[model samples]
Target chain A: MEVAYLGPIGSFSYRAVKLAFPDAKLTPVATLVDVIEAYEEGRVDLALVPIENSIEGPVNLTIDQLFHQSSAHVVAEIVLPIVQNLLVVDAKRAPEKIFSHPQALAQTREYLSEHFPQASSVPVASTALAAEIVQQHPTLAYAAVANLDAADFYGLVPLAKGIQDVAQNNTRFWVLGEKQPHIALPSTAQKVTLALTLPENLPGALHKAISTFAWRGIDMTKIESRPLKTVLGQYFFIIDLVSNDNIKYACKEMESLGITVRNLGKYCIYEGEK
Target chain B: MEVAYLGPIGSFSYRAVKLAFPDAKLTPVATLVDVIEAYEEGRVDLALVPIENSIEGPVNLTIDQLFHQSSAHVVAEIVLPIVQNLLVVDAKRAPEKIFSHPQALAQTREYLSEHFPQASSVPVASTALAAEIVQQHPTLAYAAVANLDAADFYGLVPLAKGIQDVAQNNTRFWVLGEKQPHIALPSTAQKVTLALTLPENLPGALHKAISTFAWRGIDMTKIESRPLKTVLGQYFFIIDLVSNDNIKYACKEMESLGITVRNLGKYCIYEGEK
Candidate 1:
């Protein structure tokens, strides 16, 4: 299968796509939209996108795209451990400035504060791009927080390692495609993803809709709403159910109560076990 | 009232906070965590943090912080339109590169792709900081996408104005405080907020919980869920309802169904007219 992932070949998302489908032909895109567009345009059989990071929470871009594009299904899921290092152009630089992706910088704020007391840190769009900037600048006084692969690609030397506040940092990626992969056991799988919205503004309408799930003992894994963008008050919801069958029933019940329901498909169960 | 906001002054969050609390004392912090910490330490009576943007969706850092710190209440909400401008130190300087906050850069990707095809765009943590970078590196042919206030502060001229692809781009900020504000309404308000979690490994539990709200005819304004972090599959939801009474009733019903209900407080209706 041909797979599309975000990158310049060394990005974490690229690694994730490879890890999940090792033998698949890979295509790299610069943005999430490109990846989705590639999938929608039939350029790739499947696309891998980062959905959430353990430290950063959900990636809104991916979620928004998933909601907007109705054709793709979340076919598989993968969680990859993230390790960031502060790489520099020279060992004796005593870097006066550091650059990294905003999320990476946020994750390593405490470490940077404590260790690089006088250094000014700036955010970049991506860790790999930050490394590329440091290399192109010809400044030994700058460092970048990125993965080892990014450092190698940009010809930077590791200045410090394991800078993230949480040592167990991990990012979760979802594989999206037109066809849903068949899971071995549908009963054993524990999570179901659904997208829905309520009818026009009516007093006490949302409380009544959610009660259907709560009343039936369906555990919601996730529930996020975005404005319909057409009307001021209308909003749409993306919810995840603990059981696939439970979700089917819940969707039926929700529709009966005038709440529109759309199942986005499911992936491997997160058993909550390490 | 004294309010704390994230910024170096002239930042989007700062403007949003000022717009929300016109007569209040606004304290600017470099980070959102500082804004939350100030409120937690009682240094500020309230805090305003950006929660989501129309183009970008939710601000995961602020949302994750809300989940991380359970004591704060979201007392009010405000949505402000965002217009990004490309500012440069010298108009004559050939724009070889551009810099901006990641969000700003992402929001203006189409503009950059069309207008500055050859320019390399760099992302920073804040627009104000990006403006500062341009000022410091005046000899370099660089520009930044920032608000007019930031351009004026850094003495940069606007190379281009309102470059964002989405004209309806807006950001929503949550006014957080130790206690919910008691705003007496001339008419009954139409918004309520709640936090909830379902029982462990329970099938169809979430569906049952939400069904109560649906049955009560309450319209949901917003609904979002975050992983508990402590457990992989466990999640907690942050929901907004049309009426406090309806949400209260739905909570009672959910609790009876064995769902853990946490009331994060409610606020007056947000019509977005202001």
Candidate 2:
């Protein structure tokens, strides 16, 4: 199957797709939208996008895109450990500036602050692209925070390895496709994803709507609220719940409480451990 | 009063500071950390940082920095309308490449996709920096998405205006200070902010935590989860509730239910009219 990912080849998303499908035909797209568009146009069977990172939190654009384009289904998820390295043009270059993707740069701010306090940190579109820039401007006295694979791909040398502040830095990627997976159910599997909106600007309106899930003993794994572009103070909640029982009853109860609940899909457990 | 913002004069954060306190002494810092550091160092009475945007959602670094520092309190908030413009060297320059801050670039993606479909988009450290790059390399045919002020500062002309797809786009900026304002009584404040964490990975842990506020008729204004950075499964929730009641009781109840609750600070209610 053809799998799409965001990249210039050496991105974490590219590595994630390779890890998940191993030998799948991989197409690297420039933006997350490109991946979604490719999947929508049937250019690829599945696409991987980074949803959240342990250090940087949720990638808001990815979440918004998921909500905006309701056609795709999150078929699988993968957590990739992120290791940011300071790649330089050459060992001889005395780097006065560092470049990296915005997220990566933010993730390694503490390290950059503590170590290279004098160097100016620049944000780039992508880490691989930063490496490419360093390769093109070999005498520019610049370094980039990127993966070792990217450094190797762009013929750059490592200035420093594992520069991220946190050793436990990891990012969770969602695999989106046209159809949900058809895996045999496991007894331990118990989760549901739902997107819903509350009634109006009434006091405690959202609380009342979400109460149904709580009262029914359903555990919320994730609950994110995005402003409904149409009206002020209105939002749509993308919720993930853990419950072996069917969510139909709770969802109905929520709707009865003036919540417009939309069942995106029900799938096997998240299997977060994997 | 002196107000510090993360920037170099024409940065988005600087514009936010200007929007909030027009006559205040605006100190431009190199980084967001510097903004916070200036506040901590008593160099600035107030600091403005972009917290969230309509197009980009929350700025994770700002949130994490706030959480990590914890010394400052969010005294006030402002939502500024963001209008990004494409500034180029000249019409004859017919820029084949574009540069912008990652967030600005992301916000203008749809516009850029439609207008400059084939041009490569690069992310610069900041909008002002992008403008500066265009100024220094006028013959390189590079355009930047920045504010009108930034374009003027760099002697560039607008190639396109209001390039963001969302017309009513706005970014929420928080004014953080060393001490919380002593507002004698909570006004008809419809929103309260709190930071808390779940007890454990139990089946209905979050459900129980959220039920306390919901069952008590508290409307949730916002709910965002961030990884605590302590453990794999642990997460911290930054929530805004609608209530003028004593939040201490809610905090106590949440703690009683084995949840860890921290009262960050509460200010006047957000009108949501903006």
Best by TM-score: 2
What's the number of clashes in each of the models?
Answer: 44, 0
State TM-scores per candidate. Answer: 0.81, 0.86
TM-score of chain B of each: 0.86, 0.82
Runs in model 2 lying further than 4 Å from the true structure: A54-58, A89-96, A112-120, A138-141, A179-191, A201-205, A265-274, B54-58, B89-95, B113-120, B139-141, B179-190, B201-205, B246-248, B255-258, B269-274
C-alpha lDDT of residue A163 in model 2: 84
After superposition on all C-alphas, the RMSD of every candidate to the true structure, in Å, is: 4.6, 4.2
Scanning candidate 2 chain A in windows of ten residues, the lowest lDDT window is: A181-190
Residues B1-274 of candidate 2 have per-residue lDDT tens digits of 7888877767767666665566777888766667777888888898877778522224766777778665677776665668899998896656788988766877899899888888988766568888988899977889999988888788999988889877766677777875543322223343457777776755566666677776666667788777777787567888887655756677788888778777656655322223
Docking quality tier of model 2: acceptable
TM-score of 1: 0.81
Candidate 2: how close is chain B to the reference, as a TM-score? 0.82
lDDT at position B119, candidate 1: 95
